[model samples]
Target chain A: MKVGVLHSRIRRDEKLLLNELRERDHAVHKLDVRDRSFSIDQAGDQFATLELVVDRCLSSSRSRYLTAWCERHDIPVVNSATTAATCADKVRTSLALSEAGIPTPRTEVAFSIDAALDIMDDLGYPCVLKPVVGSWGRLMARIESRNMAESLLEHKATLGHYEHKVFYLQEYIETEGEDLRIVATDGVPIAGMRRSSDHWITNAARGAEVASIEVDSELETLVANVDAAVGGGLLGIDLMETQDGYTVHEVNHSVEFNALNSVAPIDVPSAVVDWLESICLETTAVSS
Target chain B: MTDEACIVCDATVALPADVELGEIVDCLTCGSELEVTGIDPYALEEAPELEEDWGE
Candidate 1:
């Protein structure tokens, strides 16, 4: 199988996957997003030749654009352009999850500071105000009081980017200072990790402690539901345990699994490569 | 007597008079991609690793 890895950097997260692909004797092509220059109207031969390309790009804009180009020119990418668009934007992710009847954080988006404060007030203190398009627990504010929310909103309102004006507010879940990240491919949970922190945010990148979580039936079902809700591919499904059950906060395309790999008993990269093999084989069979 | 140096090969390269910030310059000697990181000293760095978050 020929696999195209679209990336700008070969960090540990990427190296893991590449090793797995090579171990299985699949031909791996590395396309650096930074060095790559291609025509939108006509794809270059290198990109056009790949049977299946994995979108591991670090830049969201690059990922979306390159995947869109691939889709336009009939290249099958894991976590397709549609999925990338939905997952890369929090506002779109919320709509997709909620629309699918999945239990996600109750979110409200406002355009102005006043409207945002009003929504934040309604949601109450300790709620989260996040950038519509961001990751790694950056630019996320947990409002503890009206003054704080006001200040944050005022700061965000004045930012130059249009996305800053979009006040994405969410009702914070009462998780036990921790959350779950399940890496799934096509709605199947390949590995699961529980991330805990002294602070509210529990992202691994933010120094959250990660430990393996047994994939119970309920968790597996939620993984599948959340994965499908946001257009399934390779995804990092974030879940917060609620009083009733699990509430999905986000589903990530271009999902990273280096952290999950460290804690998970299963070899995540191997399973992922296996999945890629199946996708290639299936596509080849159908086309031939 | 241009002072711009390639970030990768440390070799000198001529920059266009109107070269702008964020412009990518390929190293003539090493062929490494260099990005204009600063202009005051006319500095360059091996292009910053391009990355974006997953909203973790």
Candidate 2:
């Protein structure tokens, strides 16, 4: 089977996964999405034949366009364009999760500046401010006061870009300085990790420490439900332990498996490759 | 100010720029409902602008 991995810089986690795929006799093609002239046909020619495309690139107009093209060509993508779009946008994810009856923090979205200002009154102060369509905890801020929230909202209004079209204000659920990252494939939870640090953010990119944890049956059920709700073949569910119980913080359709692998007992890369191979074989069978 | 069209609704009605975001305005021509897109062109210049500081 052949697979194409799209991203600008290949990180250690990605490298491990690629090496494992090669060892398993699966042709792995690494293509930088930034190459403006890069074509799927050209990249597919390098490999035996394109069976699936795994998008690892950050959210960008070009990356989004490429993923959409792959979907148009009937190429089985790990996380399709729709899932990526929903995952990339915090507001959309929150709304979808809410509709799915998945437990998540309360969120509100406003398109107009006046609406944003008024919405703040409803959400109250000390809420989190995040770009409606962002990831990796970038551009996420906690507005501790009304003045700060107003200033941030005004700034967002002036930008007039889609990224600033709306703001996501979630009721901050106080936690014990840690969160769980559960990785799943095809609605089956495979690995789990607990991230802890001094910072309020528990993102691996934010220098949080990660440790493997056993997946309890309840947690596995929650992870599976989230995976099914996301409809993404692979997903990363970030759950926050609150006083009430566990609430999903976010669902990452595109995740870097390396951090989770550091503490996980099983070889995640190999597992991911095995999953991809089965998907490829299934597609081949259906086509033929 | 009373003779000018609303910035969002295009109605022949005067309203302050700091009006509530949820206030709906009516189109005089089509009578269609319109809400503000939250942007105030007059305040555009006063907004804190940040140029892309790529690779400092």
Candidate 3:
């Protein structure tokens, strides 16, 4: 089997996957998106022979565009471009989850600062303002009052980036400083982890303490539903335990799992490779 | 093992035998983040800073 790992900087998560693939005697090609160029009608020789490409690009824009390019070249890539497109934008992810009847935090998008203020007024203070395209909990604020909202909105408006102008606001879910991250492929969960932190943002990159978690029947059902909603590939489904139950806050296409791997009972990288092998076999069979 | 100069401090930085490309290593003398750019002759360059869209 031949596998291509698309990445910019090789993080620990990518190293694990690459080691697993190499251990299985798979020909692993390291495709650095920054060093490579893609033509509309052609794929580089490095991409020509790989059976599958795993998108591990750190940049969301690069991931979205590179995956689409691979798809155009008829090369099978894990976490399809459709999934990438949907997960790349917070607004689109929220809409996809809502349209599928999946429980997600109440979210609204506003074009102007005034419109955003109006939505903020209705939702009241203590809501979350997130960048439409970002990860690791960066550029997210907990608006505690009208003054705070206005100050943040002014800064964002004047930042000059078109993305900053688009305000994505959501109701802040109280989770007691904890949340869940489940890694799945095609909707079936491989393993789960809990992120706990003193700060509001419980992202692993934010120094949240991580531990392995058990996926009960309810979470399993929701995971499957998320896969259906987001058009499965390799997905990281983030959920918060609410008074009602579990509510999905975000779905990540190119998810990192080094922390999860350290605590998970099963070898996460091995399980990931298992899924990749199965998909490769399926693709090969179809092509034959 | 390979020896290369730190792009930031020009100090000799030793790389591990299995160092992979784009692998980030901190310069012991200067504490600068250096990325492995080549394997044959062993080249090191300053790692780029993270961009806003760079995350999962």
Candidate 4:
């Protein structure tokens, strides 16, 4: 089998996958997105022979573009172009979850600062303001007061990027500084972890403490629904425990799992490669 | 093991016996994050700065 790991920097997560593939005697091609260019007419020699390519680019923009390019060249990519396109944007992910009748946070998007303020006024203070396209809790503001909201909005307005101008506001769930991150394949939960922190954001990237979680029947059901809502491959589904139950706040396409691997009872990367091998075999069979 | 010059400070830095490609190592002298772009020829480049759109 031939596998291409599409990445910018090889994080610990990518290294595990590469090592697993090598152990299985598969031809692993390290496709560096930083120093490569793609033509419309060709996938070029590096990408032409691979049976599968994993979208592991750190930059969301690069991941979206590279996956789309690979798709255009008829190369099979995990978390297909449609999945990557939808999951990369917060607005799109929210809509997909909402339309699918999945339990999610109440979210609103405002194009102008005044409109955002008005929406915030209605929702009251202590809501979250986020960049439409971001992760790791970057640029996420917990609006505790009107003054704080104004200051954050002003800074965003001055930042000058078009993404900053688009205000993504959501109802802040009182999870007591804890949340769930479940790594899943399609609709099936591979393993789960609880991210806890003193700050409001509980992302592992932000120094959150992680612990292994049991994938119960309820979690399984919710994740399956999320996979159906948004097209699935390898997905990181983030959920917040509300009074009602768990509400999905975000879904990540190119999900990272080094933190999970350390604590998980199962070998996270091996399970991932098992899924990848299945994908490669199916793709190969179809092409042959 | 390999000894390479820090791209920022020009100080001698000792790399580990087994450093993988794309692994980030910090220069002790200048504290700059350098990435291992090549292993065979032993190359180093300053890591790219974080962009707004860079995230998982």
lDDT of each: 0.83, 0.70, 0.91, 0.89
> TM-score, each model?
0.85, 0.78, 0.96, 0.95
Candidate 2 vs 4: which has more TM-score: 4
Model 2 interface CAPRI class: incorrect
Worst 10 residues of 4 chain A by lDDT: A34-43
Segments in model 3 whose C-alpha atoms lie over 4 Å from true places: B1-5, B10-16, B28-30
Off by over 4 Å in 1: B1-56
Question: Per-residue alpha-carbon lDDT of model 4 for A1-288, expressed as tens digits?
Answer: 888888888777888888888999999888888787878788887788888999998889988888899899999998788888889999999999999999988899999889999999888879999888888899888999889989889999987598889899998888989999999998899999999999999999889999999998999999999998888899999998888888999999989899999999999999999999899889988998
By the lDDT metric, which is better: model 3 or model 4? 3
Q: What's the candidate order when arranged by decreasing DockQ? A: 3, 4, 1, 2
Displacement of the residue A58 alpha carbon in candidate 4, Å: 0.6
Q: Cα deviation of A45 in candidate 1 (Å)? A: 1.7
Best candidate (score: DockQ): 3
- Quote the lDDT for B16 in model 3: 81
C-alpha lDDT of candidate 4 relative to the true structure:
0.89
lDDT of 3 at A218: 96
Identify the superior model by DockQ, candidate 1 or candidate 4. 4
Clashing residue pairs found in predicted model 3: none
Q: Per-residue lDDT of A1-288 in model 2, one digit per residue for the tens?
A: 778887644455566776788788877776666454656554344433678888876544444566777777677776778777667667777877888888988887777766766777777776787776555676777777778877888887786476676666777767757999988887788799999988777788779999999999878888877776766677888999877778998888767788898899998988888788888898889989
Ranking of models by TM-score: 3, 4, 1, 2
TM-score of chain A of each: 0.98, 0.91, 0.98, 0.98
Q: Candidate 1: give the clashing pairs.
A: A58-B52, A135-B55, A136-B56
**If you superpose only chain B onto the true chain B, what TM-score does each candidate give?**
0.71, 0.37, 0.82, 0.82
